[model samples]
Target: MYTDQLKRKLIIKKPIQRIVSLVPSQTELLIDLGLEEKVVGITKFCIHPYYLKQNKKIVGGTKNIKINVIKKLNPDIILCNKEENTEEIVAECEKIAPVHVSDIYTLDDCLELIHQYGNLFNCRTEADKITQKINFKLNDFKTFIHNMPKKKVAYFIWRNPWMVAGNNNFINHLLTLNNFDNIYNSKSRYPEIELKKIRLEGDPDFVLLSSEPYPFKEEHAFEIGRFTHHAKTIFVDGEMFSWYGSRLLKAFDYFKKLHNRII
Candidate 1:
């Protein structure tokens, strides 16, 4: 018996021989766990390994999983995230195999997920090593940001009815870790509001346009900058801020550069 991040018990009678990763970050994580051979199915968005598109069975996109494709693969365990995956999809996948749902909002949770994967896949040693590396880089980032001024930021994830990386989410947690205070801290998860409204309430010190979920480009940053005259607007890599897996090995370094650019 194994308990996932969601505290749901997973019954594993045998070694995990086939893994179907529904989340992009966890797909990279499974590979980092040295379970590459066991990764039989991945979503179309699981493009980290690049070769995955050519090698593995594409079960479908994160939001629109192909049931027939998934059934064909017959995964032993399906890795999912609470935010990235929907309840209906999870319920459907549950009928086939045990689904490990991860609800992540902090660095500790990420480290625990690595350990959980270790336990699930019988790779405790590799998990420990990856944990250490993530921690080491985390510490380095802390040191790098030491004595830096805390800056209020408006992190945009979408446009139209503009949405922000709000409080109590992984993006906000990572922002705080890097000393970027979310201006939308009072709001709930991914609140949709006008950039002009946010600027009127309190002009952020920085306005970040994320390169995901909406794929904000350099032009979007300039557009947001118009409303936030007091802020420095720039395009940020969404993966570094949102990815809760092995890609974190590179996040701290990216943060260092980001902070330097901000300063």
Candidate 2:
């Protein structure tokens, strides 16, 4: 019988209408995928695109999410990352809504994540166009940097702890793509090394201090500058190097500007 008491619950198969992104990279990706109206909440760390600051509600950071605030947002989908977000936060968010986690380390991982997001958002066409554009730009950058002499570069992610990006990181891949050889390839992922060791044998051609994780300032550069005589130390945007999403579309031009300034 079609009585309300005998009716079964229906499942909705529509695309997610409201999304809350825990990771900054995924937030930027969602925005790039034309999901601005769909995204209702974002982490405080999701500062890229600049306008997110004005429009999006802060649900907390990647490591620490405001679960109560998130519940209030009533997001249908919550996007996060394995490296950037903690398991507890993911589990808590799962209680509120379905959560999709992305793990990205290399260029291939980035492309795969893009494809997955495309499928998830029902925006496969736009995703394919973006992927093609990114691939073309990356290929062009590779060709341009291929002939140039490889420079030894040390990318710093933290200051007091003295942590630097290692071979398994996206920044390392980007550096290799840009014809810059990472001095910390021996170590895996972000490793803590002594400044004395860096002074003794690191001998990097360039020292890139990231703006996040430690917020390296110009004065800090002057401090590290003493150790590296041949290396030119500059404060670089952490997002440009680490974000593996649509932010990458804008990274090539930034890289070109950086290359021109350095070379």
Candidate 3:
């Protein structure tokens, strides 16, 4: 038994057979970890491995998990995240099985989680392959990044009320890796701000709109452009920027393409 991100010791004396993953990113990881048969439940948002939803029982969305459905599932282990799941849900899940919570803030944290998942699921070789791939890509991206100039950027995850990814988060970490300096680095986490006030003064060089949580479209970027003429708006894959799982294996290529787009 060892401590998870929440410092809760998870007792998995026997092999983990049935698992309920509460996070989409982690759900994708379970697939990468070769635990497809073991994963009996996942959220509706666990759309990666696309057939997963059709085959597995979806407990609910990330923010709102169906507790009764989870209890009925009688999972031996529940995979969750500190940011994606609530404490109350964790408690309820613990009642059914050992809930291992992950707190991911950086690329290292993501790799570490993958490592831990390997230990948890008895898939060490596969997990090592995944992390190795991620590390190789990270280093390759770093080499490319070393030659690039730092670009000021504003990454938006939501619309309507207008919220942007700030400091000390996974999205910001990717932004940093790309040498895309976050203009909102002064702020922590996602912050609601007035898009109408986007002036030329200290404004971002680019306004990146994510395709998840809010699903910002090409039209949305154009709409935001009217308010901020200083920044060139672009629609980016939400998964590449936010997903801290096996999806990261493809992020560096996307990042390289994105980096080439900027002057």
Most accurate candidate by lDDT: 1
- Model 1 earns a TM-score of 0.97
Candidate 1 residue lDDT tens string, 1-263: 89999899999877889999999999999898899999999999998988987999989899999988888888899988999999999999998899999999999999999999998899999999999999999888788888888898888899998999889899999999888888889889999887677677668988888888898877887788878866788889999999988999999999988987878
Give one digit per residue, the lDDT tens place, for model 2 in 1-263: 11111122222255589999998988888888888999999988888788787898998888988899999998887887778888798789879877777777777788887887787778998889889989988888877676788888899998787899998878898888788888998899999988767756568989999887788888888877788867899788887899897878888888888888888
* RMSD in angstroms between candidate 1 and the native structure over all alpha carbons: 1.1
Show where candidate 3 strays beyond 4 Å: none
Candidate 2 — worst ten consecutive residues by lDDT sum?
1-10
Candidate models: Cα lDDT each: 0.89, 0.82, 0.88
* lDDT tens digits, residue span 1-263, model 3: 85687677998877889999999999988888888999999999999988999999999988899999999888999988999998888888888899999999998899889888888888899999999999999898898889778888889988889999999889998888888888888889998978877654347889999888898888888878887756888888999999998989999999888878776
The TM-score leader among the candidates is 1
Q: How many clashing pairs in candidate 2?
A: 0
Candidate 3, lDDT over the whole model: 0.88
